[model samples]
Target chain A: MEFSTIIQILDSAVRLSTPLLLACLAGLYSERSGIFDIGLEGKMLAGAFAAGAMSAYAGMPVTEGGLGMTWGMAWMGVLAAVAVSIVLAMIHGFASITLRGNQLISGVAINFFAAGSTVLIGQHWFRSGGQTPPLSGAQRFGPINLPFADAVKDVPFLGPIYEGLISGHNILVYIAIATVPLTSWLLFRTRFGLRLRAVGENPGAVDTAGISVVRQRYAAVLIAGILCGLAGAYLSLGTSAAGFVKDMSAGKGFIALAALIFAKWRPRAALGACLLFGLLEAIGNRYQSIDLGAFVVPVQFMQALPYILTVVILAGFIGKAIPPAAGGEPYVKER
Target chain B: MNKGLPKWADVVLIPLLSLLLAFLVSGLVVMFIGKDPIQAVQVMVSGALGKFGIGYTLYYTTNFIFTGLAVAIAFHARMFNIGGEGQAGIGGVGVAAVLLSVAWPHWTIAIVAASLGAMAFGAAWAAIPAYLQAKRGSHIVITTIMFNWIGSALIVYLLVGPMQAPGMVPETVGFSAGAAIPTLHDIFPAFDKHAPANVSLFLALIAAFAVWVLVWKTRLGYEIRAFGHSEKAAVYAGISPLKIIMVVMLISGGLAGMMAVNTVQGEAERLILDTVQGAGFVGIAVALMGRSHPVGVVLAAFLFGILYQGGGELSFEMGIPREMIVVIQALVIMFVGSLENMVRIPVERLFVRFDKGAA
Candidate 1:
């Protein structure tokens, strides 16, 4: 492949991985806090719908049945995404934490609920076959060019790499990348983070320390909701599509969950894992099939690679991927 | 051994109450969409239970029964086999391969061979995940989910490359006429001739009864339930976790595979992409609502059948998306599976108070 081709693939990879990175961080918070969340897909879907609807409404004129606002309304869309995702997360928390129900089942229910309701409500509102109206300037997160991107573009190999790979992403992409270091700092340096990790590993110990296990878990779930909301918003707003398509998350959430496992629940590793998955996807998208002199590889195989790799990793072929000790179990006070 | 609630209440009442709650929420959603909730229910009832609709309902019920039992059997061993969709899809391939291999003289013989082929293929698909879960401690849920994606990809490859018919369509040629299972209308002339409900419905019922017998009346069943209740206790009692896991998964996968007979051989009579549809996930809701019991699974399967058939009608008549049924199914699973304690605690308290008064 040519250098520019590689750069282009990497560019798309960066764009695609932003959502995975965000959702992976979301899963990192929830799973590290001992709550196994298979519902990340559902939360992201709900968030995407909320963001898409809000942004579209914000972009339209007042006479055309819209909020008639510009630039700042996209932020409101992100907020709406977060709020809706948080509500769904609270439902999962209520079922798993308070009701002490099966975490996996709750996740499954959430997925079905989101998959069904997003389109149901979207169609009811838009009558566009479950899709929000296409967004435009000021309504979507337009790409941002870093300082000297234009000046540096004509310089050399390193210049094209810098401008093409690093600079022009929507605000959410930057936020997603920035979140990794912030997450690492919060998880490792803060007292709250210590208690949060403790609850996932050993809730009884945290409980003995007079830290409320429930409160820690709820907090973790809330953070997961916020991160997932951003990921969803990024999908509908930050991407070139600039509209919510039905089922548009398209298994990205599961891929994010897989990235979380591949990363072993670390923020830095998650970024790397998400990028790797993203590159795989970008390569698949760029070239429908790769040709070698001897034979050809099909696109389906490429599409299935991430899931296949996750299974291989899960099977302990590479290494044992152990979950947090209390993950998937409800904390019972007296049991 | 008696809990706060009576046995009958535990078996039937809780699910009924959950169903009621699910419908109540569904009604609210309908109202939110500026549609009449009562009228929607009326359309659903007539669309699912009316003479023309009942045949389709039964056909859907047949698919759900196989998938529901598949999940329920795995549930007994505390394994969540979420790959029913993949298993059933692969099972369709098996049925297609078997039915296409020979032009049998009799439908009965062909059905038997196709059923075996379907079960074998489904079990084979599930074998890897079961082994990984049993030996390496890989999470079954994650592995099975990955398998669903892998299985779909495999189907696409097969349909496009090797198994493609001599046409533009991404499907196999129709199965031999003898291999085709007779629809319900063939035996009962009163039913709609085009409806897909077929003899596979009987097979599903038989499978359900067999599952009940295997789970409750057999030593293997005892070991599975014992393992599910407490893995350490079962291990101490000499029950092999590996054996229970593998056997239970094989049975589950085989049962899931049987759904192909209804959809592939009986209805479509050709191998097509997405043959299983979302019936596999519906199995999860059914198994949960049924409390992982065979009888309950059948009843829950019928309820989902109504939702599916009715939802299809709602899409045509009421402009409600077919996905509305999925929403209702999700709510039912939420209430019955995850939020049981929400109802159980209050009911238990009431029952305890009543017992105290009687004493």
Candidate 2:
């Protein structure tokens, strides 16, 4: 492949992986704190719908049942997405924590709830066949050019790479990229991180250390909600399509979970795993099929690659993937 | 948990109360969307149970029964098999291959052969995840979910490439007329002729009974329940975890695959892209609400069947999306499966008070 072609692919990979990166980090927090979250997909879907609907409403005129605001109101959309996702995360926490119900069951229920409610309510409110109105102009997150992108464009080999691959994404993409290091620091270099990791691996020890297990778990779940909300917001507002379509998240949340497993639940590794999955997706989107000398590789196979790789990783064909010891089990304080 | 409640109440009443709670929450959702909740229920009932609609209701019920039993069997082995969607999809491929291979002399022989093909293919698809869980220590939930995506992709590849008919559509050609199963209308003569309810409904009932026999009356059934209750104790008793996991998953996968017979050979009569729809996930709700009991599965499956048929009608008449049924299904799972203690504890307390008063 030419350097320019490679750069283009990397650009697409970065764009596509933003959501996966956000959701993967979200899972990292939740899973690291001993709560197995299967509902990340559901929460992301709900957040996408909330952000899409809210942004569309904000952009429209007051006469048409909107807030009559401009680009500034897009922030409100992000806030709405976060709030809605947090509510759902709290519901999952309530079911698995307070009620001590099966975490998997709660996750399954949340997924269905989000899948159904988003469409049902969207159809009721917007009447657009379960889609938010298409967004444009300031209503969506337009790409931002880095300071020297224009100046560096004339420089041969390094110019295109810097401009095309590294710079010029919506703010959410930059936030998603920045979040990787921030998450690594929060998870490994902080006092709270120790307690969080301890709680996931050995809640009994955390309890003995005079920490409140329930509070820590709920906090982790909340952070997961916030990160997932950013992922959803990016899906709806940051993408070029710039509006919510039905099922637009389209199993990305699960892919993020797969990336989490592939990464062995580490922050930096999650970025690499997500980007690799994203690169596969970008290649699939760019080409219908690749002609090899002997056989053709179909787009369907490319689309299915991440899932296949995740299964391979999980089966220990690559490496052993072990979850936190206390993950997925509700903690009951022994009297 | 049910120390104060009678056996009958534990088996029957708690579920009913939970169902009521689910419906109540669903009603609130309907009302929140500015629809009349009572009118929604009324419409759902008439549309699902009315003469013409009952046929469709039963058709959906047939699919649910098969998938629900699949989940229930795995639940008995203490495994959560969420790949019913993929298993059923591949089962359709199996049905199509069988029905399209050659001309059959009769529908009876064809249906039997196709059913076997469906079961085999479904079991084959599930075997990897089962083996991984049993031997490699992989999480079955994650692997099965990945398998669901992979299965769908494989189906898409098949439909678009080798299986594609001469036309532009990405579907297989219709099966031979001899391969088609008898619809409910052909047998009853009074049923709706347009509806898809077919001889496979009887198969579903038979499968339910067979599952009950397999889970309760047989030695294998005892071992499964024992393993489900306590894996350590079951292993101590000489029951191998590997044997139970593999056998249970194969059976579960086979049961889920049987659903394709109803949809493929009986109704659609061809392999299409979304053959399983979301019926696989609906099975999870049914199994949870059914408490993994055969009798309870039948009842819960019927309830979901009504919701599905009625929800379709609701979308047509009231402009409510058909997804309303999915929302209700979620609520039922939440109440019956996840939040069971919320209702059970209060009910247990009430029963304890009543017992004290009697004493």
Candidate 3:
């Protein structure tokens, strides 16, 4: 491949993988904490809508509207989204943990509620059936040009890679990448991590040891909500600056679940899995752009790739990838 | 008053409570939206119940019975086979394909072939998810949801592409005249032209009875029920979960596919002619609301059928958004999710093995 084309591919890959990475990290937090949170997609969509609506209401000031939008304002919007998502995730945790309801059913219910509430609210607020007004380009995330890339433009591989792919990414892309090791550390190397893992594998053991399952799961779900919120923000503030549309998260949350399986529920492994699925999705979308006329792949088939791969990965490989022993079992404390 | 009538009262009571709660909550939402909540509800009710409303409601109920039966059958085997929607799509496709390919002159042969073809296709579709679950120990929930999306896209591609009937509006070709379900109007000279209710309703009723017998009266039923209670125990009894999973999923899928006979053969007369709609998913709510009993399911389906038919009529008469029906449906599912919590009173559990009878 030409050096420029290689650089282009790398750039596209980062952009494509951002949302998946954020979602996987979110899944890691919740599942690791002993809550089987299958409602990540709903959480992310809610966050996206919150961010989009907030931006629209604020009316992009010309100063903050440009691609050079300060890190502060973007972070503020992302933080707000996270806060909103956290509230919703808390509801999920309350239902599953506190009420001892069926986690799967509760999660599905959350998804339906999210889907309906967001659309109804958005339609009323924006006077549209779906979607918010697009953010001004100034308000949208733009590329960052690092120092020395200009000087290294003459270098063969290193120069092209630095100047082309890594330089122009939006802020969220960097955050998504950095989260992998951070999540891994949080999941495997800390006191909290041990407790979290113990709760998932053997909640009764955790409870016997005096650690509260409710507290641990609530924390885990909150972390999940934050990450999901960031993922949502990336879709609106980072990718398109377009408002949230109905069912905008699509099936990405489930794809993240698949990534967890592909990674064998390990945070670091999940990064590779997310990247792989993202690569498939990125390639599938571009297949039509670079067509082999006789070998034309239908868009429907192409779109089905991630889900199909999920099924294959879950059903074919990953032999004996067991979840936490007490994953779906609700803990009831006798007063 | 009939014997065991109090038990039946609970059945009506629970759904009615859910309905009332959904309406009240939604009414508040409508008032917030600056619409007349009372008028909106009035329009919705009259539209569903007035004049020929009963006919359409029964037609809608027919689809629900098949979908609900499909879901309940799988639940009895402890399988969460959520691919009813996908299976329905494929089944509808099979019906459409048969209608297009068949040159049969008799309507009876064509209708039977379409229905059977649909059931077979649905069974095969569900088997894929069941196989993944039994063989690989993969969770069926995620796989089945994926299959629903894939199935939907497949139908969309086929209908708008290769399966497109000539001059049809993004739909399949019209079925042969012989393939149409014999309408009540044809059987009764004085029948209403506006009402097209057919014999599919009777088929739904018979299917419910058959399902009841299958779940409660036979050795296989015992095995199925045993598996549902505890898979490990079922395995200890020498019953293979793999075999049962496959059998139950296929049976469930086949029943769900039968909805096409009601909709395609009975109403639309061709599959590609319309969208798969959400009957299959709604079936889940029906089964849950019915507490997974065949008799209860029929009643629940009819109640929902009325709301669905009436909701549309309300939209026209009272100027409420038609989507209000969807809101209500979602509420019903929500309430079903919380029903166990709502009824913490621990009434008699009928499905559990009877100690006295066993002794």
Candidate 4:
């Protein structure tokens, strides 16, 4: 394979990995706080719709019959998406925390509710066939040309790769990358992280410390909401795809869950898993059929690879995946 | 916060209140969307229960009953089997293979053979996740979900590549007439003349009863409940977790597999793409609403059957998005299954007060 082709693939992989990375990390926080979030997909879908609708309503070109807000105001869309996601996170927290509900059932209900409500609201508000209007200019994220990108262009090997693959992603991609370490530190080195992990592992210990398990879990869920909200914003505003399509998240959210498990719920490991899945996706996108002269691997196989890998990983082909001890169980103070 | 409730209130009153709350919120959402909530309900009732609509409703109800029973059986063992969608898809392949393999002399033999094949295929498919959960400690929920996607991809590959009809169409060839189950219209001429509701409905009812008996009356059922309630105690009592998980999944998968019969043999008479159409997921809601009981599953299935048929009509006639029904169903599941304690707590308190007064 040529270097440029590899660069292109890596570049797309970075782009595609952003949403999955963000969503996976979001799940890590929620699950580590003892709330098994099977509704990441639902939350991401809700985020995507909120971002697209808000951006379109605010910053689609007035020439194209938009709401006439400036490009800078388009970021209000991200804010709106975050708000919507937080509300969902609160509902999840309420159902699973305050009520001590079945977390999986709550998650499943959220998925259904999110999928239905978003489409219904989208059609009701926009009337654009369950899609937001086209976004333009600053409403959509454009590539950020890093300082010295041109200066590094002439350097050998690493130069072209850096310029082509690393230096030119929307800001959200950068945020997603930076999040891995931040999440790692927060999960490992911070006081809140210590309490969070303790709560997930043994909430009784945390509760005895006078820290409310419900409050800690709620905080973790809210963090998840913020990260997932950013993911949704990136999907609509960061990528070249500037509009929300109905059910556009497809299975990405579920794939994120797979990544969370594949990474064994570690933030650093999650980064690798997300990027690996992203690379596989990128390969499928580019190479409909990979040819090595003698034989070709079918696109169907390529498309199915991630799910297959998820199954194999979850089946302990590699290692035992131990979830946080108290995951999916609503923490009961007395019990 | 009270834990105890009268048995009658535990089963009936909680679900009723939850259903009422779900509908109340759904009504608010409908009104918010500029549609009259009352009119929407009226339309839904008329569309789902009208003679013409009842047939379609029952057809959908038949599908849910199989899948709901599938879920309920797994629930009995505390195994969350979320892969009913994929199992049903695989079951469709089994049904198609059997239907295509022979020119049977009679529908009776053909239907029985197909039913057996579907159960086997679904059970086999489910066994993968079950094995992982039992032997590897992999969470059943995540593994089953992955399998759902894999199953869909496999079906797409087969339908597009190998199983495609000789012509350009993307489905398998139609089943032989001998393999086709008789529609309700054929069995009961006195009933609606063109109902797609079929004999599979009867089979679904029988399967529900079978599951109930298996769960409540049999020694196996006792072991399953014991294991689900306390694996440590059950183990001490000599019950094998592996055996229970594997057996429960197989039975659940078999019941889920039976869902394909309604669509493949009873209605479409071919293994078409998306034949299951999220009924597998809907089964989760149905089983929850039914409280994982056979009698409750039947009633819950009928309720969802009505929503589905009526939702379609609602979207068509009143311009209300059919997806609204999904919100309602999810709300019902949330309130009834997850937040059952919300109602149960208050009801228990009330019952305790009544008991104290009587004393």
* Best candidate according to DockQ: 1
B107 in model 1: Cα distance from truth in Å?
Answer: 0.9
Mark the regions of model 4 whose C-alpha exceeds 4 Å error after superposition. Answer: A60-66, A291-296
Model 3 pairs in collision: A65-A138, A65-A139, A66-A138, A66-A139, A67-A138, B43-B314, B48-B310, B107-B178, B264-B269
Q: What shift in Å separates residue A89 of candidate 2 from its native position after superposition?
A: 0.3
Between candidates 1 and 3, the lDDT winner: 1
Q: Candidate 2 — what's its lDDT?
A: 0.91
| Interface Cα RMSD of candidate 4 | 1.4
C-alpha RMSD over true interface residues, model 3:
2.2
lDDT of 2 by residue, B1-359 (tens): 56868998887888889889999999999999999999999999999998899999999999999999999999999999999999999988999998889998899999999999999988888889999999998888888888999999999999999999998899999998899899999999888889899999999999999999999999999999999999999999999999999999999999999999999999999999998988888989999888899998999899999999999999988989988988999999888988887888888999999999999
Model 4 lDDT per residue over B173-249, tens place:
99888887888878777557676798899999999898888899999999999998999999999999999999999
Q: Over the stretch B126-211, how does candidate 1's per-residue lDDT look in tens digits?
A: 99999999999887987888889999999998899889999889999888788877889999998988788999999999999999
Tens digit of per-residue lDDT, candidate 1, span A1-335: 78999999999999989999999999999999999898999999999999999999987899999989967878888999999999999999999988988999999899999999999999999999999999888878988999999899988898988799999889999999999999999999999999989999999999988889999999999999999999999999899878899998877887788788878888999999999988888887888877886988888888887778778877777576777889988998975
Regarding DockQ, does 2 or 4 come out ahead?
2
Candidate 2 chain B lowest-lDDT run of ten: B1-10
Q: Candidate 2: list runs displaced more than 4 Å.
A: none
Cα lDDT tens digits, model 4, A120-215, are 888898886778877788787788989889899989898988799889898889989999999999989999999989989999999998999988
By DockQ thresholds, what CAPRI class is model 1?
high
Interface root-mean-square deviation (Å) of every model: 1.0, 1.1, 2.2, 1.4
Q: Give the lDDT of residue A195 in candidate 2.
A: 88
iRMSD computed for candidate 2: 1.1
Model 3's CAPRI class is: acceptable
